[model samples]
Target: MNTTQELTLFDNESEVELFKHKITLEKIKNELINFGLTSNQSKVFIYLGKYGSKTASEIAKALQLPRTETYHLVNSLQNMGLVTAELSHPTKYTSLEMKKAIATLVKQEQQRIEYLAGKEESLSQMWNELPFFVVETDESKSEKMQLLHGLAAITNKIKEMVGSSTENIRVFGSMADVLRLYHSDVFDWIDNAPTELKMVISPMTKKPEFVSDLDQDKIRSLVSGSDKKCFVINDSKEILIFMRNANHPTRQTFAWWSDSETLVEMMSMLFDLSWEKGEMV
Candidate 1:
């Protein structure tokens, strides 16, 4: 840890947004790459920003970039006025002036947003002629919807019906719970848990390789680590399975989760028999 670490702790939106691009397997790492900074340059800056002030050696170790290459980047950030060297003892560089760096990023983003907004506005205006109903919700209904906005209510309802399910949750459809509903931290909790996970993927999902040869791995790991540690039962009992949008709670989109024992048990039985047959690929 060093100067970069110090600044990165304050890593506001833009820095965080960098990694958001390649989160899904749908996109590759290059898709997240920015032309403004070389991968090494970005790595060094990101490391220093996240790790705080650090010696060149620390930056190299933390970023796992080669020492000689790191020195090149250190020189580059300094030349670009993005990083400053400390005068005292062990000699470290920092990138604490996030205001400028982030502002530069924001300016570019603003220009892009402006362009997109202009296009969107034009499209909306053109589509104005399309017949659409303006269903004005009564104040009472709006207030009721607001009260039920919490997904905890949805999950809580499932829990109430099934009673604390010890079995792993079987999920179908795309990663609705994660992409649409919960934060990564909460998903991590679900993923790392001993709960079983069985997914009958929807056509909307791109099935990853090795799904049915020996050990099928999907609908997990995208959130948590360690594939083998999971209990993955097909046909879950007391688990909610639905085709809901992950962002529904926020977007006010409606979704449903079934708490039926019949569905859960059937899924569980299929999972057990498949496990014996090496259906997991």
Candidate 2:
């Protein structure tokens, strides 16, 4: 082949290799996240693993992270025994081998689970010792609505709804909303809930890993056009509708929740229609 054609061929091959490398990196990062490291922490650990020891400034520059954040990540990783720091002129950091790192994370997680399990009985006893009372009023019979601001409040409300649901629960939303719920442990709550669950997600979004763990018959993807709207209907008695802009940050997000018969009925109808239109997962 001529020089130009040969160079073009080489460029194409280089691009393909680069793409493959990126995919591999992403896979590693995801596995690291699954092992309990945050996204940035995974990235930092992978960088150190691949590039060997690096000074904090070098790591920050290489990863394009803020210097302060990089230092914090390194310190956290060191404390977790996944990264080590050397007492050199410029302190350098090194990641534990991938196998050892995984073992360390697994041990930490096991310790955490055991600690919680050990405290469960005492915690339950303490909780039971606290008396609970409910004041009955005319207001209690009336419909109620609550505006939840911020992700923490929204997550807690969803958890409460899931925990209280007894019959059926339906979730219809954009994939981003579903992912947010998963990250907030709402999925875990739902998994342990006694209620039946049905979910419909936007057609264009890729299925998430957690989808495979759920009943295939209960979850589906909308085959028609998609939108950013999201809502959850619990036992046809209440609804929570996301009101925040999809592109906005989580801190600025908010949701509307209501137990009004009219509102709940309307959202239930919408969810039913969406479920009918959804394609099996």
Candidate 3:
């Protein structure tokens, strides 16, 4: 057709094709980066993917990277199961099928989850052993009190208090709050521990299914009246109070825990008065 187009030499046509191939290589490299490969690693992988197989030197020269760096990238890709290397003269590396490579990554992630699940108990024990960094005035540690927030923090404090009880554990709360603890197996921990439990459920709330299963001699229900607030006194050692607005549209709850003997003694006296009015279950 056109005279200038017809006169184009072989070298010119080959250069144009090389330029288009480079553009394609850049797109493939970006996709590989998103798939979790490092930049250099992605470059090497795409090279092998598109060019079939390549020796480390060939890859280094084609990508204009140092030969030693190319070897490192290839080794990392092989370890990730994205590439495979053959033991031959000037060994060649080739990428696995994209689907198979991604499948391998997924498998590794699932294994990590299982491993963490297996170590959860030991991990929790280690976490609890770490000291809390609190800045406080000069006072006996046994007389210290800490404000707790979030459901998780409150639950942990309750478990710790219950576990440390030597004589008795007193609980006062609504049937709904009791049911939450029961479903979470807090009762199982209480039952296994060497502590007596006395619970006072609000008059507005009904008994839960696990009520009958509890120790009757230690259980009680508030007959006159009770509020939605909850508290736990672990003998004379500690007291945990949960202040809540049950009917509030926001359904907010907050808790406080203290080892202060003065504060705990006051709570214990209140618990005694409530115990006297409660109907034994």
Model 3: how far residue 117 lies from native, Å: 8.5
TM-score, cand. 3 vs. native: 0.50
lDDT (10s digit) by residue, model 3, range 152-253? 567778888778877888887777667766775777878888988888776534656679898877877775565567788898888888765233212145
The sequence of per-residue lDDT tens digits that candidate 2 reaches over residues 94-118 is 9999999999999999999899999
lDDT value for model 3? 0.74
Q: How high is each candidate's TM-score? A: 0.28, 0.52, 0.50
Q: Taking the tens digit of each residue's C-alpha lDDT, what string does model 1 give over 42-117?
A: 6677667755789988777766668898889898778766788999677799984557875765676688879998
Query: What's the candidate order when arranged by decreasing lDDT?
Result: 2, 3, 1
Q: Tell me how many clashing residue pairs each candidate has.
A: 34, 0, 0
Point out where model 1 deviates above 4 Å.
Answer: 1-152, 155-163, 175-178, 181-186, 204-236, 241-249, 255-259, 266-281
Candidate 3 local lDDT, residue 197: 84
lDDT of 2 at 136: 88
Q: After superposition, how far is residue 213 of candidate 2 from its true place, in Å?
A: 1.9
The candidate with the higher TM-score, 2 or 3, is 2
lDDT of 1: 0.50
